[model samples]
Target: MAHQSTHETVDARRIEVIAPNFKRRLSGVTTTIVQLVPAQRADGLEIAALGPGLPRHLPKLRYRDLWRLRRPPQARAQRVWHARRNTEMVGGLVLRDVLRMPLKLVFTSASQRHHQPFSRWLISRMDYVVSTSRKTAGYLERPSTVILHGIDLARFRPPGEKFAAKRAVGLDPNRKIVGCFGRVRRQKGTDLFVSALVEPLRANPDWIAIVAGRTTEKHTGYAAELRARIEGEGLSDRILFVGEHTDIERWYQALDLFIAPQRWEGFGLTPLEAMASGVPVIATNVGAFPELIIEGKTGIVLPDLEPSTMQEAASRLMKDDGMRAAMSSAALAHVAAHFSVAREVAELRAVYDAVSPPAETRAGNAP
Candidate 1:
């Protein structure tokens, strides 16, 4: 009964935009929706999220509310259904074709690889498509507007004092900190980061490294093995696996350097997040890392997944305080100019405007 009331309330709210997240787990796509929905709303777009596992603070559409898409809401423009995942794309097709919802389906593709036939068919049905990067756009059979992801600058700004930030997070304030954050698994290059930092961290007593983020149930053994390696090297104190953090921006603020050693990625955002927090990064040339990092300015970009490559880059950055400081400044400036959430939202608004129905059509269908 309570759920039914909530559905009616959401239905009557006249959501002009619907961002769907069919996946329950908080993935990169889910994170994007959570961050961008509010920013879109702040820009005077009546955007609401639909699906499970989203936070309650954001406006949400219940399953029943999908029915409203069939008839234009009284005071609203035509609805834009933004989909990121394959499942959401499929659902949007059913609503738009089978039920004949007055929805403009827009899909944002982040994957850089070739798609299967099933996925390609879904892509063919989108009214418009957006790619998160140029590389992502290359994978699409149809032309797509390239719009890179952006970080919320306000939430990810640098702390006034790095040492104080470290101390606030129960880390050693005196040590120079480097961080590798994300899921702890082989594909994410957790072992690569651990191996690269082990020797460098051991040699430099003043330096400490952090491996933040959790290992899934399947990857528990991998995490344990990495821990054992750190313990065996007698660098457990210096190389810490502090696990997953809720306040990840604080961790980025506390770092002098950040490393993204992923072997492969669809589109990694940690490098941008680290840069936004005024820290330089060392990232492998995978996904959009090469495009995001300004080599010799914001951070170094390595060509391979070799641990020695990351080690060399990290060693160089660590040894030169002046270079690190310059890179940190450049990193912050680069992000502010090119990667803020405001920029992403504005670009997305343009896409929505281009694809959404005309005011007259919307008004004509109004209840």
Candidate 2:
């Protein structure tokens, strides 16, 4: 019932997880809801091919279920058949087999891109299509649904003391902290964050920054380049690299501000989490940032994602305690109202009921 549920539960409703990375925040929260559907009931499988060795807490669906359900096969025939078969299977199992059962199909991000053909095919058949961002939802012409991923306020709640996080993370608590957490990749705009944000904040001795997450992939070299830039700018002492850590919320609490200078994002879950933790967020105005943030109210959004503009916004937030406090309070209130798990789940369930065939009272003969 709690959207922040960590344990596994099952039921009769057929809920599928089409997200590729089950361990990621969106997939994790989506799966948490799927778990509550009741037992012996085969809901939809969340097909995230994010490789093996997932977290133990994540439930395991049959391999066939995952492989069969994943969007748009490279082969044309296979993709069509897959969607059709999925539709028929869900329709039969939920509508014909169990009269009162419900069926819900959800997918996110790049998965929508990969499976567009299959997605369009399944759209008319699906009870609900959940898009993580309105931009993503716009890609779908059909009547669809949206649930920007919800953060677990229970875990990501504001820390009792902000300084404790800085101390715990080996940062100087005396310095004003501006931090970014999440995978360091081109799409995430790590380069932009450093150039746009970190460089501008360099003028203030009180401002320090930490970029945390694995920088060892193809992006490792890029990370190296960023480090080199920091050194070149004489900011070695100011910027710290805190690689990947399991306890990320601790990192959230450590910061005076949270910065996400991404080029584009899909309903960025982190900002919501940061807001829930009562940290003021300064993010690029791309994807769902406009939807999640209330400009100067909940958080500040960069009008132009350029480095100069970004740096200016970051500098403004860093310098103004009154504005930061107002934004922080507003951020928490915004999350509680719009991004709360209960609100999202309730909306999703309504979609499920509306789309469920038996639940549909539209008379076939009605004019």
Candidate 3:
């Protein structure tokens, strides 16, 4: 697909924060930059993104802009290099340690596992570290600020007419739509989500399920196998694989329940998105699912990763009108109170401030 940046690249001298996307693919790390940069800029931070796959509204910094970073931006001695990936950390090191640019390196880790030696070494070189969740913080080589991710509330919100939204998405307006979104791969537990829905979908004619996400060349076979299973169950029509959508917020509006069925994850965001859209979620006990869900309130966190657990909970919630409605209201309220994008941006800004202080506070030139 063709991508463009409508917002002109910000001048290097004016930027205090330089958020980079080393990987071009639409992964979680890239998604974070896309969502956070505009909000941070709106809050009056001198932030500009670096690298590809970012939206048009986000201010970007080009490859040639690095030369301008030799001197610091206007108000600080050093610019903040915020990296979520190892490659980005390497770039920061090249600019700071090798080329000797006035940059304060910061790395944000979302992984739950202990870091490998090389990663730990790179992380040790950082001026500040941020862990996306408290669970994520536990795996870090050094102390980190636990700043949970938040959604764009204006984009992912409760639709006034839920049934109309389903129809708008070309789904059955009468049926309760249960959706599983994200990349369609085994690690994501797409097969598990499909299996769980089969018995429930067959038993409950009023409900239908949609699997929405990208299926890359490598995962085509895996996705095809999952489709075969759905067809075998004679649920080809009842279970739909609508592929990925740019406007996924509308899919959230059409959902009665959302499921994050990942077997493992690094600080997942789908549950938070669903709740923000006023849709209850049934997520697996993995990643930040436990941290994100308000068990028996906003959503149900499976006690185990078993498909049976997901199946039972999904089936029960689809049938319980009172419970789902109450949870839906509670989910929306919880996100607005705790997980708006503004909150995430503010917390991150705090981290950036500590390392790259204002010009008045600096005693000498940055190292």
Q: Which candidate is the best by lDDT?
A: 3
Candidate 1 per-residue lDDT, tens place, 132-201, comes to 8889999999999999889899989899988799999998899899999999999899999998997788
Candidate 3: worst-modelled 10 consecutive residues by lDDT: 358-367
Local accuracy of candidate 3 as per-residue lDDT tens digits, 1-367: 7885577668788999999998877788988898898899999999998888877777999888789999988888799999999999999999999999999999999999988999999999999999988999988868999999999999999998988999999999999989999999999999989989988997889999999999999999998899898889999999899988999999999999899999999989999999999999999988988998999999999998888999999989988989999999999999999999999999998898799887766655456
Please give the CA lDDT of all the candidate structures. 0.88, 0.62, 0.91
Clashing pairs in model 1, backbone N/Cα/C closer than 3 A: none
Residue by residue across 214-275, what tens digits does model 2's lDDT show? Answer: 76566778788888998898888777788888788888888888988888764567788789
Q: Estimate each model's TM-score.
A: 0.94, 0.73, 0.95
Higher-scoring candidate on TM-score, 1 or 2: 1
Clashing pairs counted in every model = 0, 10, 0
Give the number of colliding residue pairs in candidate 3.
Answer: 0
